[model samples]
Target: QFVLPDANLGVIAFIRLAGIKADQLLKNCPKEYWVPGLTYMSEWSHQWLDYVTRTSGRLTKSVRFCDLGDFKMSMLEREVTRRDGEAMGVMEDCYPQLLQTVFLCNASSWIQVPWRLLRPIMPKRVTSKFEIISPETNVHERKMLLQYIDEENLPTRFGGKNAVWPVHFPLPEN
Candidate 1:
């Protein structure tokens, strides 16, 4: 998922799904919920998907194959603690919409597979006009950002050298 703030900067979310397996990707979405498994996407990210899907621009899925065979997906599940009554799980199947949204995103996608993930069964990658390079470390990531992001807007963490830091906010207790 990404955030295109007025198209000047593209914020691509490159989260590491360390111990998660293919089927366990949305393990905490809860089958009983009205939103089905897609709840794991969060309302905010779904809005971003709506925007990017309509525009068909600046989306990438760079995957890496890591050795995580011993990791337990069950261990990652969060316990339910409710302050309000029955607000979380209201069952309805939302898989169709989720599938369609994913398909639309894939239509305008640039997928990158690290060399370790290259397999004979994998599909051939199509060439993209837009350059979507995934740098290994923060140093390399900063260099890649230099091409698309201006020095003023880029974060210091990514080697922007900007003096100011982004505001930190605590997560909502809800």
Candidate 2:
């Protein structure tokens, strides 16, 4: 059986369709490590052939930031090189600032939602607020927020959009 911790809720729904016991699998993992938002899994029967050929490993801390900078740079370099040398020169002039602005905007939005949400969850802890002081809220605020979240070592990528927001849900009374 393939186990995923704190995986997306969808996996549970998926297991139900195949008459597999999801609750038992979930019970095997510790409560704190089970990130309900991040976990995802598929039944062994659905793709048995692929499963037989593949190797699986435990989800350790090291698995989390998989050389993202190198991967991104490689992709960018490949795409640029695919174009003619003259085109690459033009792109070099036009891309860096524009790309930086886009990344900043996405990061800013990520930081803002958590700031508003986390206050109710962890009231006593320090909270980072995203200020929209500049006309370039999409650019400047986002860049600032990305830097702040990175320093805190929070998970940032949520399906290409940074999910820097912290989620807190109250536990059920025993």
Candidate 3:
């Protein structure tokens, strides 16, 4: 995920699905790996909470932008869903409302399948923050994204002017 340069409106963590390799992910990442991962995220979330509280008070929260372009059903493997559910559960238990919104863009109807499965496992507060958008096809969705995120903070590919975090950039080294 790439953090947008503009922080006037809070952090905007961007993620794109096009670069993911389903087979490689499943082969490489085992379910046992996520527990420690969630722990690390919890630590990070606490730091983020402290930072947001110090800067803009407790009400401010970070948002996520998930670009679903080129998303495939193969990416929704059972292991993936299970890990995601665990992660969301951890977030709810520890961070609570740390994430203000999750903008899902360029999504197709196929999203319903995973949403249906995952929604049942997620709490209302967590699920409520999600905003499924189709900026590629629907004008209303695009407007909604722009309403939440300003054009200058968004990448040009996502209808913004930020060239530093382009959609096609090479993945950063971990």
Task: Give me the displacement of residue 21 in model 3, in angstroms.
Answer: 2.1
Q: Residue 70's C-alpha lDDT in candidate 3?
A: 79
Local error of candidate 2 at 47, Å? Answer: 33
When 2 and 3 are scored with TM-score, the better candidate is 3
Evaluated against the true structure, the overall lDDT of model 3 is 0.67
Per-model TM-score versus the true fold: 0.31, 0.17, 0.72
How does each model score on lDDT?
0.34, 0.27, 0.67
Candidate 1: lDDT of 32?
64
Residue pairs whose backbone atoms clash in candidate 2:
6-34, 6-35, 6-36, 6-39, 7-38, 7-39, 8-39, 108-142
Q: 91-151 in candidate 2: lDDT tens per residue?
A: 3353322111112122234444665576567644222222222212234433443332332
lDDT of 1 by residue, 4-89 (tens): 32232222332223334444433544546624333553344445444555566654222111222233444343432231112223
Off by over 4 Å in 3: 2-4, 112-127, 136-140, 164-174
lDDT winner among the candidates? 3
* Residue 11 displacement in candidate 3 (angstroms): 2.4
Top-TM-score structure, candidate number? 3
lDDT of 1: 0.34
Model 3: per-residue Cα lDDT over 45-90, one tens digit each: 4565456567766465767788887787666667666776887777
Models ranked on lDDT? 3, 1, 2
Give the winner by TM-score: 1 or 2: 1
Candidate 1, which segments miss by more than 4 Å at Cα?
A: 1-11, 14-29, 34-43, 49-114, 117-121, 125-142, 145-174
